[model samples]
Target: MLIQSIIVGLIIAAAVVYGVVTLSRKRSAFSTKPGCGSDCGCNSGGKKLPS
Candidate 1:
């Protein structure tokens, strides 16, 4: 039916919009920081470890 098709289309559009917003938020959060995020596991915080 036409109503069923319209509902499906709306659901798909909503899902796409939600994904875009989530990704943008994550990108902005990372960009606001200077170095890599804390969870990067790089252990390179500009400090030298003991030899």
Candidate 2:
């Protein structure tokens, strides 16, 4: 019973740590220029007509 409880506690701790790491890294994964990472051509200064 004690071993089971310890295993459960460790699993919960790992989950919490993973959640924090995911949230912390989210900002760095984002880009201010929506088109900079793609070849969508939206980053070009020229205006695009509606298709």
Candidate 3:
């Protein structure tokens, strides 16, 4: 029973870690789009779309 508990604990820890890593990798997408890239006029024309 102790081993099972430990295994469950590790699984939960791993899930938490995975979630943190995924969020960190997507930090860029979480920010504003800077109102279009250098080769476009979509976002720079006026009000930007929902992010």
Per-model TM-score versus the true fold? 0.61, 0.56, 0.55
lDDT of each: 0.75, 0.72, 0.75
Name the 10 consecutive residues with the lowest summed lDDT in model 2.
31-40
Order by TM-score, highest first: 1, 2, 3
lDDT of 1 by residue, 1-51 (tens): 999999999999999999999999999976635554444534566344455
Over 4 Å off in model 3, which ranges?
29-51
Cα error, residue 20 of model 3, in Å, equals 0.2
**RMSD (Cα, Å) of model 1:** 5.3
Tens-digit per-residue lDDT, 1-51, candidate 3: 999999999999999999999998799666545666544455566554466
Which regions of candidate 1 deviate over 4 angstroms?
Answer: 33-51
Instruction: Supply the TM-score for candidate 3.
Output: 0.55
Ranking 1 against 2 by TM-score, winner: 1
Clashing pairs in 3: none
* Model 2 segments more than 4 A misplaced: 31-51
lDDT rank, highest first?
A: 3, 1, 2
Per-residue lDDT tens digits of candidate 2, residues 5-27?
99999999999999999987896
Clashes of each: 0, 0, 0
